[model samples]
Target chain A: MTQKTLRKGNEALAEGAIRAGARFFAGYPITPQNEVPEYMAAHMADNGGAFVQAESEVAAINMVYGAAATGTRSMTSSSSPGISLKQEGITYLASADLPCLIVNVMRGGPGLGSISGAQGDYFQATRGGGNGDYHIIVLAPNSVEELGNFPKLGFDLAEKYRMPCMILADGILGQMMESMAFNFDPVDPNKIGKFDWAVDIHKNGRKKSKVFSYKGDNLIADVTERAKRYGLIEKTEARYEARNCEGADVILVAYGLSSRACLEAVSKAEEKGLKVGLFRPITLWPFPSKALKEVSQKAKGILVVEQSLGQLVQDVKLAVGDSVPVGLNAYPAGGQPDGEQILTAAKSLLTGKKEGLFDLQTHAEGFTYECKRDLSLGVQGDRKEVK
Target chain B: MSTILAKKPSTLTDLPMHYCPGCGHGIVHRLLAETFEELNIADRVIGVAPVGCAVFADDYFTCDTVQGAHGRGPAIATGVKRSKPGAIVFSYQGDGDLASIGMAEIVHAAVRSENITVIFINNAIYGMTGGQMAPTTLVGQVATTAPKGRDPKMQGWPINMCEMLSQITGSKYLARVAVDTPQNVLKAKACIKKAFENQVNNVGFSMVEVISQCPTNWHASVEQALEFVRTKMIPQYPLGVFKDEGAK
Candidate 1:
């Protein structure tokens, strides 16, 4: 029987991991995601599972690496700075073709920026943060309901692809409370098909299997094989949500927390006789580029709204190409853009009033200009330019 | 009919090791193989190879093995042990890999009392990286980095891992042993066996710090290296059990 309950996003993510047959969880303390480990530490033992509040984020991720190699569904969660520390182990997991779940309940930052909600880690999540020709399957969930469901999806994708799958949630979604349902049957960890290559005692006299990332003399062949797997994943799994995108004048592209605001903005813009629709990417990697390209043919302009300065705008540009103009309405570092703000930006983008707004590359250029312009003046010039 | 006095353990594969001539890793590897065989856990044992000289350890062990990033062997072994508690897991690390870069991992693994065994090879120098200084490098020891004998003022004192780990309550067994002499080699094997036994019993974290000779790194002959272990290394890293919570 399915059960619905009001739950925080971090707690829902942890519960979803448990239901997905993740028998092992190792994580350290971090903001917005602290509830994840706290919940796991309390409930994991009841389900014949193990939980370790690891000494550090590095230890926690490597612990996941170890458990995953044994063919167990294992996981770890952290915020931005902590996720940075886990990159080495994540790369190792990718190299070894070990499956595991990693959740980044992202807080603001290039450093320890803030404890507030931000999608600043889009590049780090979608693109490879670690040193390797590898990509982690990245799933970005906007609501608590999706948070309650995506861990199972993330684990399945990770196991199917033999790579780490990331649940990239921001601080708002992590801390917000919403009603969620557990509709699917919980999987049995033991019954999740045996991995022939796992390190186990039940090999039954066959050659002992090893799990390692070293390519030695076969580096080129090894990387090519990995790239082929990624290609297959892209073909099979590019997920997104398109709302009222057909026959719309403007399409607002966003993900995670920003996507929620964009959805509300779509409705507000429509009510005001302006035609705007929302395109929310559920899987940040294997991005719904094809869908965006199709939607771009119908829409006159694309406005990308995000918590960071302008990370997702680049992807929007790539998806739309030179077919339509793409502008960014970004709330830099920890600030949340409201529905009205997004609606105004969408209208401005449609009217081509891009004087104060930013595009794909100009956002960075704008920041550089602000830095130089501020230094040119003796005093702290203007706060508007900084934002 | 020939009576076999000593034969290679079945746990050891036929592949030739890459250890330099007279390096202590070969002896340590043989000891681990023999221990696995004698304990009757050879087939079920999974080993973690460090990124130092033993990086290719997966080729030598008949049992399943994984290579950990430099200094991450214990963290990796912790994951392996927790996931498959029925399987016997161990990590083999060098001084630079363990006492230096991996200090945090080993310390916390001990604090958590993870039920696994660690075979720490403390040769006092980075062997694979061409004789660089290690955390366990003896005071006044000369290396590429410390050409003028290591100064206590410039570099800190040698880290005593077993003694440091003994203070942690989670560690069930801790020992420091040498493989310099024939009799000492036998003792070192016994120490290693007990450490693995503790893990088999699911006691807690157990570690055997082997005071091994690195002839190439020490820039000496095998005999001179053995003498160095006897005269120099032994005094700083005395051979004995530091802790044994599992002892009767």
Candidate 2:
């Protein structure tokens, strides 16, 4: 357990979950996150688990619903498009108060956008993508080590709160290989205590358990009671990593993969004698608002950097409202920003320059796309001349 | 004659069901509970209820139950069975629930040879949603959607689930039964029992499609609905065991 071996982000998270006592996994194939299910199919049986190659993403998540209802530690993994397909089951699990883990190795999208890594699903993950007033625990891990570590933490949080938990990594984080090891020893389901509410086998005069989401008459009471749990989670579970925000004039706020870029940018800012700090939220749902609010007090400018077009900035703006001048540097829809690009944005925030800002208005003025396709392929010629 | 004739199965709960008068669902529910009790697997039985009129089917069973989204019973049942292989899981579904919106799930569940039982009630109309045309509606059946009495050229044919599922290699057992007469009801019970028995014996993917009558949806009296099943519905959906791959 102490040894660290090189592993892909997707594969490491899969093994991490197996160690965390995820005894069931059901998922349909999708880009970037295929390794998670593939790894599960190979190793889950060896560790006393079930792996289902479901017909579709819809079927896969419902399988997770079924397994979780029976008090088994269940999970499913998918990319952006597949995750969208799982919203129905996710909302059902949330409504029924079933605990399970969902991993979204994100790709570009509005439709089947691209297979490249993007943080376009920030709103989807943090803002309850399903049709309900519910919040799932969202853990945004930045590195391979965090990816390997978050599944155990995610599973524990999901069970403790009796809600769905998500590990929101992107295509880059999933496919890129790095050295990381699981932090916890492998868990045994036999040693675990059974949940009283689980709809498993009935035995010896015990009242049979019923797991259903249709509260009909008590729908109001059920949802309202669950809202109290969400409120408690919001207050206590907000997590983030702060770096050098003591006396900075500019601070960069980001999460997941984008945070890694901001971390390097912070050091570059200090070397250039530019006062800059970084606040990376690990729990995107809870948003680390209070901590960011405290960190923003000493700063004059807050630069929100993200892979999506100004999505994370909205949360940052809400967290640090009216106190600081907020700016956005969005590298949206498969756009991966490097440390230099973030540092340039940081430098512009310190000065009165608009060069580094990539907001909708600024970026919109830079390009005028023409709707034209190359029509050269339609020309007919002799077979020899065609070459 | 004073001796106990037919008490309800112990697996059935005391909770009252919200079914329509003369509905076939009541009969099917009784047969399932009896199957669980007779097989001595009631303690390990888990029922997945669908989202039609029988959405509250879980409440009627003393066994552990789960109610999921409409047409997702098979996927959920597959999950429950795979997680606890020793547990006997069944998905109770309606015609519209199994054949229409949930076609992909039911078909794939069979294709995977999953060890589960499906109690399919084909009443030819969507009863809970107020008599809409279902995927199993007869060619000339009058429904809210098929007001012109279901033009075959436009609405297509009623899907024969047993006949269709019988061709699939993974489908181990398939039967179409009815609850029209006393004799047919007993026959239907035998088929329902066989479907559950298949799961208990680890025989993969068994389903018993009951050709039921919906007096409310059919706009007929209970007697007329029963007569219609014998005269009209059964001729199209016919009764008898279609396939049985026992113990395999």
Candidate 3:
């Protein structure tokens, strides 16, 4: 049996990157994810890696871009707003066909909502938040073990596809401590073969190499070629974990920390003589849609559980596409759903009660009270009172 | 056979540059190419090209080049150089790139004293974007964005990179030169060589700001552009070694 040691999720992920031969790391301080850069600063240099606490998230991502061009495994991590700052660099990295890891330790947002964990960044992560037609492979880790182990998997997929890979976890997973053992041997990049297109010392009489994203004339052709890879990835890489999904009355769809609640709900639903299934997507971008469609075939209805109000439900709807009734159990703005809460939502799905189950619309409708306008204030600059 | 007095640097490719006539980029590129040949570090040299006029510098120089988004050359160069200490990394930037959008990157790279060389081309206008005001655009100079001719109160003062960077404790060498006259061109090349030599010795951060000419953007003919560089631009950005820790 492998010995497990207690480690914070953020530290585990950082150590995972180091063990996976990520030789370059650049990051800035942001809540929940601050431990990531802290761990890198402490351990990266001793492990023969370069760690930079960049002046900003924008600079950090660009540094990753430069390191990636040299065929070094590079990474940067931040929360929502910081991740937003990195989007420009992320698009450039994808355009230049550079592989690197980007970790988004999600926090409440629309903008600086809170430092507490939230799943509000689902659309941003899966939809390629940057401006351009590109998709980065996104992984959702539910456990501290997966958080510690996902870097190797993320790096492999990124290098194989020659694009960026993101590990999307909320603040809860980042702060929580768990006993997890690394599943892979420590990597030594010195022994790895070099990438031919990498910008490095010209050895063996190789011609000068250029790594650039400015494809002036060949932009369309390059995008079309990249789309083919996206299609292939969609066909090839979609992983999920399913329980009692063969033929259940209701199926619960969730990911990351939210999935853990769904898993517990599934087990409890079994004890209650209700056949509820849980389908948790591990790979969020190549989002296990086909597998989901297969598992949800026999289910009468589907309930999407997530920390956000409706972000994950969008992908869930797209996957099932009205073949079955889809419902949402939402907790927006840094709210976490417990197993009991999820189980009640699952029961509501089975009973066909749309009251508290699909309450997002109801809540929106509840906010329809007329705004009390001050007559004295009038309409801003066009004040009614003659001064 | 006639004895050849001079030839093009080996590292400079035969490809014709797309720079406008009377532009200083051609001269500066040649100077860097010559430095690479002299130092015999062409194979190990990693050149970072920014999003300005010199974006196609990868094609001009026979080196491993990484061209990235605007104003990020220094950060990228730091990444490349730190990953492989044996590699000679140089981030080549224009006024708009280094001074404006990428100000923090350049300042922080200098602050950290990353062992790299910086080749800054200061022409006072955004070249690739076509005659816009740059961070180094002189007060009272007419730019497309500043049609009123760079009012000091409205627009901020032009940045002198060498003099500004000289104050940075981490910077080892900071020189500002020009390629307008034949003598100054030679002097610029020597300054450029010294910057690269500092990197070769792995001492600290070194930057050589070349006061370049942009005829098209300056709305001047070749002769007028060179004259503007010599008279108008040189006075505002005085040529000198602002700081040289090695000399001390």
TM-score of chain B of each: 0.98, 0.97, 0.98
Candidate 1 Cα errors over 4 Å, as ranges: A359-387
Fnat, model by model in order, equals: 0.64, 0.80, 0.79
Ranking by TM-score, best first? 1, 3, 2
By DockQ, the better pick of 1 and 3 is 3
Which candidate has the top score in TM-score? 1
- TM-score of candidate 2 on Cα atoms, chains taken together: 0.95
Q: Model 1 Cα displacement at A56 (Å)?
A: 0.2
Write out the backbone clash pairs for model 1: none
Against the true structure, what is each candidate's TM-score?
0.96, 0.95, 0.95
Q: For candidate 3, lDDT tens digit of each residue in B1-248?
A: 89988899889999999999889999999999999998888889999998989999889988999999899999999889978888999999999999999999999999999999999999999999889999899989999999989988999899888888888999999999999989999999999999999998877999999999999999999999999988899999999898787555
Q: Considering DockQ, where higher is better, how would the candidates rank from best to worst?
A: 3, 2, 1
Cα lDDT tens digits, model 1, A302-346, are 888887766788887778788988877777677777788777667
Error of 2 at B61 (Å): 0.5
DockQ winner: 3
Worst 10 residues of 2 chain B by lDDT: B239-248
- DockQ (C-alpha based) per candidate is 0.74, 0.83, 0.84
lDDT of 1 at A185: 85
